[model samples]
Target: MPFFVYGTLRPGEHNHDRFVRGRDVRAQPAFLHGGALYDGPGHPFATDGDGTVRGALLTAAPAEYPGLLVALDRLETYLGPGDPRNLYERVVRPVEVPGSGTVRAWVYLAAPAVTRTLRANGPRIPGGDWLSHRPPRTDRLLPPPGPRTP
Candidate 1:
């Protein structure tokens, strides 16, 4: 099954380069209905809800699917269903793929505890799109101000 990724794993994001690039057979714009996105420490967390979340649907290359799945599971801290240490839970969710209608895809949603906390106090991403809602980078490396002419 394709994976619906809304956060770091989306195209051009850091994790996309590290974990998804070259491994996906195809990546296309998709949306998850009945969901919400919230700002996490350095990424974003999705929770099941009434909002719509914009994302990408990634179909893994057949040769890469097995490894990719394991890598993603590790990356998301998912350790099977109902694991106490999981940050996300891998589950099948209906993702609306452009021109293809809705299809069931793997989505990593915030674990139960994380969802509860996020609902209680986390900052919800207003637009439910992490790419557009992420905070500005404060750590960008500049070229030392062009040698600082005296």
Candidate 2:
């Protein structure tokens, strides 16, 4: 599955090699529309917008998700179903990749408030390039989205 990653977790950034693994992994510059980029304490998050936000389109083997999850957060540190960690929350958001049809790939988006707060305090990593190198922590973490229920 292809995962959209932005922040300090993108390839060749401060945190890429620790998370991205496997011979089947591939990455390319991609984007997501309808969002605004905001800086955080140690990362950045896109809020509601109409223009495309810069990021990466990660093509990985079906088995690579698990490894990526581990690098995202810590097991048993938050919850189950995936791993229990406080790195990112998984969701299926619409992404607009140039020359490619709209596709819904799994993306780990940072919480808006936390990401924004981080940005106000210090310098941001700038797009997905800086994201590839930061390690995730247990601070104010989240999980993948679940089905909407009444």
Candidate 3:
């Protein structure tokens, strides 16, 4: 089984540098057929519909699966693949990458509803799992606090 990774698991992204160290990442243009990626509570997941996501296509040794699972154990919350309750689950699915023909990759997904609801509420604040990895858009980088006045 090919384990596809999207979201923070991506190279140079937060999770990659932190846990995985992003050693063996292969670049690919992957697309999740029917779901959009969202920054959820602490990770990403798929919704009930169709959409696309992109990231790395890391090839793991057959024996590596067990170690990989253990590595992801804490990060993915052990929800048992494809379950809303789990942080991330393994799914054997197809994605469309521009250069690569219809390819199979493993991706981490979270509940879209959860993300949609969060989105509707307001922008996700930078804190906890969210405060790392992603680079800030110039507009988003807040100016330093103003000097105190008497």
Measured by lDDT, the strongest candidate is 1
Ranked candidates (TM-score, high to low): 1, 2, 3
> Over the full model, what C-alpha lDDT does candidate 3 score relative to the true structure?
0.55
| lDDT tens digits by residue: candidate 2, 2-66 | 77777655675555655674446888778777655655556666544544567888877777767
Off by over 4 Å in 3: 22-25, 81-85, 111-150
State the lDDT of candidate 1 residue by residue for 13-68, as single tens digits: 88988898876558999999999999999999999998999999999888899999
Clashes of each: 0, 20, 12
Model 3: per-residue lDDT, tens digit, 68-120? 65776567675674466764455667766667677776555543445457556
Candidate 2: stretches off by over 4 Å: 21-23, 73-87, 112-150
Q: Which of 1 and 2 is the better model by lDDT?
A: 1
**Candidate 2 overall Cα lDDT vs. reference?**
0.59
Task: Name the best candidate (by TM-score).
Answer: 1
lDDT values, one for every candidate: 0.92, 0.59, 0.55
Per-residue lDDT value at 89 in model 3:
51
Q: Give me the runs in candidate 1 sitting further than 4 Å from their true place.
A: 136-150
